[model samples]
Target: MTDLHKHDRVNPLRLPVVAVQGLWLRSTLRLASAPGGGTSGTAPGPTGPPLRLAVLGDSTAAGCGVTGDDEAFAAGFAQEVATRTRRPVDWQVVGQFGATARRVRFRLVPRLDDDLDTVVLLAGANDVLAGRGPSLWREDLTGILADLSHITHQVVVAGIPPFGLFPSIPATLGRYLGERADALNAVSREVCGRNPRTTTFIGSPAGTPPAGFFSTDRFHPSAQGYRFWANDVAARLLPAQPDA
Candidate 1:
């Protein structure tokens, strides 16, 4: 769902601040050739543990056009994480339609606790649709990521897929949305590059346009679209080591 965020600065919906722990954990399953003592430095790493993850964004994160809450992007991502890691995962959801990064900082940032392991950003589309400039969006994003420092074990930004091709929207407007997506994604990528722990943006399936993956409104993603989203994430996470 491409939800919209109000431009009001005076008051926005405030998220409840909850103290959380053990966020964004990576669980890997591997066969041990030999067991080592727990007291030794050579001890094998623990295989399974729950990772605390937070999903924050706009309408797509909110479950719009979805049949139920479970069908949303956040829910599907959680399920996928559990399956791949074989670890219990606790996910916090804070998504509002049409939210810009500014709204997220004001409405959601203050409510976050230090234990959050991962912060998944699915924003920018609405900002574009709302006709906000790229600089404004980038500045807001930088602020959001800055404030989230130390709170996130890993920072991940999802690239805005091409919204211009949606069948339901006006062609010119859709293209504008698509261009904004690409531009914002570039900013997100640059932000991630500056931080070692951050995960670069992963966009949708190759050549798949918004129209083909979205709902009838040509905004939200179809089930098949979510499938592609999950696959891209898994590709990034599946590697046991990145710096290695």
Candidate 2:
């Protein structure tokens, strides 16, 4: 069978194992606390008005798994941008713990500020876990990008995390979820390619992640992982500096 077919196929025997693991994870893993402020905050930079940034979508966007908002993905990314551009960043996070792309499109998208310099989207993992197919994933993501592109000049869509590498998941389930994530990412690339204002940020580090990359749950990123992710994204978003 083709690769697509292979991804679509599910072994009936694995259902029980998948169910047990899912239940265990749900019972054991608790979402990290959201940052102290309401969903918005400012990361100080050298000078000038803050660059407006919005991080929207699922748990990662909400900064789950990190100790606090300061150590989360959005804040870390904002800080990186501010330091590199020598300008303060006004960052906001609009996200839910288990949001899928469709949920973000309908729910979180409406919450975004009217004036934004950049919008970063972190979604699709829940959709993969939900067993949604690529077509649905593509449709939802397209609408999200369309809406965000209308609001901001730049919309950065984060690629799906490497589920196969997640420490908490079993090998069988991880492989399956990984394949699904890959499929969704392919759709993301295609959707972003069509929009001039949109770009897919596939900034995962090369090779295996080092120790402390994941939090206690081994699903969401830890502080160190957020730093790595933020640096990679900031590098791509910022323009190159001139030689001294």
Candidate 3:
């Protein structure tokens, strides 16, 4: 059959399959558009040539507290990557605000591209915030990381940041959250240690957290928070690019 077909109002692949780089991934498909024209599909396009980044995590990565889509970690991260690499960047945000590692393994992990160069993972806080045991949270994060190893050779495990100090939650609960964050970060660091392509970074509140970084909710990081995350992520990314 013809991979190339006229995608009109009736058939959207009307957009020609322009060959980019060595791979022929459908531009329209990448652009989140259907083969048929005159419609909105999830057709995402490449920034420069063909690069894929996957950012998966909880509310922070999903930009729940952030005012606009640009404020989201995924969007901000992509923008930072574009600036750093001086090329257009396309990253697919595959995270639910309260997602756990188990959910990512079964749901988000399956949707990733086989040739993904980098996979940034975040979780654990939600697991603990939900009152789940830290041991189970460790297993979930490790299992998900192991699963990602099959597809992405490079994985960046951002240790769960410290949020307990924030004024948003109760002091008692904040203490509990802080302790769990430490525990889960330990687990994540261990997992990263064992992987050849993995690296871990400690993201705690004590660092240079930008003013207004926290969203209005005072719970999640604001646009500034994501901007900081992007810079931090880029630092980790620089080292991995040579190996990737």
lDDT of 3 by residue, 96-171 (tens): 6567677777887787767776677867666655555557766777788778878776777777777555646544
**lDDT for each residue of candidate 1 in 1-244, tens digit (9 for 90 to 100):** 2222223232233201100100100022121111111110111122456677777777665555555445456656766676666666667667776677788878977766677777787787767756576688778988888877758877777877676565555444445456657777887788778875565566655675443466544456666556557566756765433321
Q: Model 2 — TM-score against the truth?
A: 0.86
* TM-score ranking of the models: 2, 1, 3
> Which pairs in model 2 have colliding backbones?
none
lDDT of 2 at 217: 68
Taking the tens digit of each residue's C-alpha lDDT, what string does model 2 give over 1-244?
0122233555667656656666666676565545322377888977788899999989888877866658888888888888888889999999898888989999999999987889999888888888787999989988887788778878888888887788887776677777778888888888788755456555355678778988876888888888888888788777755543
Tell me how many clashing residue pairs each candidate has: 8, 0, 19
Candidate 1 regions exceeding 4 Å error are 1-47, 209-212, 240-244
lDDT of 1 at 183: 71
Query: 2 or 3: which has the higher lDDT?
Result: 2
Best by TM-score: 2
TM-score of each: 0.72, 0.86, 0.71
- Model 1: weakest 10-residue lDDT segment is 17-26
Q: What is the descending lDDT order?
A: 2, 1, 3
lDDT of 3: 0.59
Error of 3 at 29 (Å): 40
**True-structure lDDT of candidate 2:** 0.79
